[model samples]
Target: MASNVQVLADSWIHLLLNLLGYGTIIIPGYFLIKYIKNSQYIERAGNGIFSRIILTCVYGNTYDKIVEDTIQAQKPRKERSSFSDCSQLIFCFLGLQVSYLTWGVLQEKIMTEEYTDLSGSIARFKDSQFLVFVNRILAFLLAGTYLMVTRQSRHKAPLYKYSYCSFSNIMSSWCQYEALKYVSFPTQVLAKASKIIPTMIMGKIVSGKKYEYYEYLTAVLISMGMTLFLLTSSETHKQSAAATTVSGVIILIGYMAFDSFTSNWQGELFTQYKMSSVQMMCGVNLFSCLFTSVSLLQQGTYFTSIEFMFRYPRFFWDCIILSICSASGQLFIYYTISCFGPVVFVIIMTIRQGLAILLSCIIYMHPLTLTQVVGVLVVFGAIFLRIYCSHRIKQINARRAAGIDSAKV
Candidate 1:
């Protein structure tokens, strides 16, 4: 009876701590949303203590600036010639392939390989949060620099709004790194490729968006492919049964959930704000760095990670290059979408995902069964089918629009 009571007490303590952690993120977001919704109340409240507190803490004297910027209409972009567009499309495709492929290899290497510690003993760097901080900080710096160098529309979105997506982004990235400890890199890559299912689900839940029948069909195909891939894994791989453990599967699920939410939230922000991609990147990474640094500091691992980096020079260089690749990858994604449209960008990314898996297998000597190969082909084939169907739908819509315009004329 006493032991049972102790266990119950510990469970309550754990639950409470989790709630507290969530509240730290949620409570602030609640107020920010409230402020955005009730800006008139803020203006009318007029120097009251509560109003002043909200304004000072949340808006920080940028209320007028944000209002002005938000109300200003964005100018439409000029159309580019076909040759220049093709050139940019090729550049972005290559940049994304190189940056993300290198990033993937370094990521797997850093997570799976052992390095020398300060005491000259081999140790693996288990601090996933620290790696997240490194990636975000560098990306934040790069985004900010890009914004400074180029002429961008004045950022009008509430800076606090970025915290919501940043929280999810950090969680997703942390899960990605953590899952690598349990799952093979190829398994993780395949799982990531199958994100359309979760993304569709998140779209419905978050935005009440509806997907077409073919979207569901493609999602099911991807699921089947993922199941076949995981179920037919060879026993000789280094990860073996451990790769498909419940813990790893759960981490991957968390990764997909957070990643889906991050993308959906980003889309919503893009619709609501006229800021450039670099501005969005800058804002999100700024909050990401803040949140991750605080968490690392609280866990007392911030300085420890730094010391580990100093001890292992190779690891230091690996981290630096990893960060650079990540930042550059984001730029490539934006550039690709801007130049070639999302259909082409999706096609390029789908190809990159396939190459990333193949590269990981070759470099790591991960043996694949014939069944697994079939699964991979099935997954990619479904993705391409979905992409083709989407293109058809767009073309159909364009024809309909042109017909309506011609009839009105």
Candidate 2:
């Protein structure tokens, strides 16, 4: 027993060392970016650093003024959409859909199977926490660079708040990847349809927000739809590896809770700090990179994942594509929310989810039962009802404010 305890302690020490090494990388990378941002020689020479080249390619100029203008293109306008605006909107919508679909398929493919024999035509592909780490790190680096170039790095909130949000964000990411290993993409999407329920519950619990009767009814419909869908999927699970599992459902539930809490926390922080969407994205992703790095290091997954990737170039490219798609989707999501309101964003996402389910079923040849069809319809109905109810509430508030203004006059 003493020897066993000693061995366990030694393992923990090794894990600690690994985590420290990852920290060394993150800290130096962050400082290097900051140093590059402040460098006078790069500004005078206009061609000294790689960051300048990237900024020039992305923004047509390496100067701060030009980068600022290019970043402004991301901002959503409240005015009428021009022809250029419409064209850009279409491009963004398509990009968002394609990126989301690609990542979903790639993740499912990577985790679905492992080759048992060397004679297999394709190499083994497995999910790695290190892949998650790399994804976060790459995204963070890109976002941080944008902030630096655009002079937005000065708008960060407290590191502690970002750290807390990062923990939740990484947890959501981890749960999602793990859940995908056990659940079909369509089933997982269906389960996630009830995300509004958790958001509502958390709002009430954490912020004391009140909801209307119709909203509660809509939540109930969503819950019923998800339950019905699950019930109808039992036979599918028996035949399909991607079918829903209890473990997957549980993990999804945890994901919903964590995601809801994190979103609300972010809202609270934004309100308190008066930060922009760009700053929120940068800060959350930056800290998320730190958290995931520590996790992959302590788990010692980076070495194994890297080794496997070297052997299977396809898997390596798949992981990279997954990360790129995810980042692209995020940018489009932010652009959409900024251009349109949250309601419009919700509608677009609802449509996207429907298409994803349809495409997944067609591509994977998964059977959808009549009960599931009805359930999906019910869920969609609930979503529309929520949208209508929200509009009604807004109208009521508008009329009340008008009445008060008239009374004051």
Candidate 3:
């Protein structure tokens, strides 16, 4: 009887332990399902404490009418006056030029210049990730401030969508900076000018958009010109030849791919959400800061970068100014894309690229070969030809639309 009792007691204890283990797993799984369902319910109902917290924390607005406002924003709105449109375009173009021109100069200075540390040792700021983090965090702050000041339509897009854009954007910028260590600024600028092809490729992939025959032709011309320019480097340009290594070419290719994706994705979001430029900026930069901060922390360079900043006052100020320019440039970028569409924005940026190359050559005295000059002219010619053809296409479409309207009348 005693042996039977002992066996039964042991079996009961084993059964209890098994039940406890199962309970631990089942309870959390049940709660997770309930939590997700509750969140979905809140989204559909557009009310409740959870929804209020999301609106306030994510959007910086706690007004009870946010859902209604978002719905109303989706409705068709009146067009702006032609004069207002022109003025906004002027502001966007000028803002982009001034802000990015300064940004380029400062970027080169920061990456290339040597500064004295507190220990009296000369060091260059090698933390490109830190620079990225600083730029993004400041842009986030500025964009948030703008959104708070100006009344914007309630944003309805899922916040996580911005992460896709932010990741590509950060990678592209990091590539740009890192490539400076490998290539001349002119080379980099010209390489970026060749992004038209990549943009079309990404457009097709991301948005399933089709292109014209002329676009393909221009893309080929641009590629040929780029190859010619890269191959025909001036013999005297030892630094240029030495810097334009295979690694530099690889990094630039990555930049083009990532940047093309970024622009296309952002444009899609604008079309889908009809969100304001500041709202887009705020959303993208918020995720940008989050990703970069986590990266910097994991790499253990966050505090070291801060210490480096304190050691060199000029570098610190340069970073601040760089961040300001970057923030301002971002606002212009989104506004231009939202207003005139990505094609017009790309045209403006292409022009800026040409000017940026010229500016870098003049200030930094980067030597250009005769072939390089011809190559540049060829590339620009192709670009301008593509632009002209695009313009004619638009005109033809407009005329056809007018004809259809007149016939209907």
- How many clashes in each candidate? 0, 1, 0
- Sort by TM-score, best first: what order? 1, 3, 2
- Residue 39 deviation, candidate 3, in Å? 7.3
Per-residue lDDT over 1-409 for candidate 1, one digit per residue giving the tens place of the 0 to 100 score: 6864574465345335434554676687787668665776555657778776556445544665566555654655575554575577678878989998888789889989999866678988977668878998999999998888989865666677788888887777767655665666567656755676677778788767777888788777876776566555543244433345566777788888887787677766665555577887888888888877766676578999999899998899999999999898877765554444333454466557556556667788988778878878887788779767876897798799999999999
lDDT of 3 by residue, 1-409 (tens): 6864564465345334433543453456457546755666445646778766554443343243466667677999785654676688779989999999999889989999999867788989987778888998999998898888988877766665687788788777766655655566557646765677778788889888788899789877776676566555442234343246566677678788888889889888897767888899999998788777766665578999999999898899999999999998998999888887665576567667555555566778878768778878887898779768976897798799999999999
Q: In candidate 2, what are the lDDT values of residues 159-250, reduced to their tens digit?
A: 44565666676667656655665566666656565566676677677556677899778777876776566555543344336656576677
lDDT for 236 in candidate 1 is 23
All candidates in order of lDDT, best leading: 3, 1, 2
Native RMSD of candidate 2 (Å): 9.2
- Candidate 2: clashing pairs of residues: 184-242
- What TM value does model 1 have? 0.73
Q: What would you estimate as the lDDT of candidate 3? A: 0.74
Give the TM-scores of the predictions, in the order they appear.
0.73, 0.64, 0.73
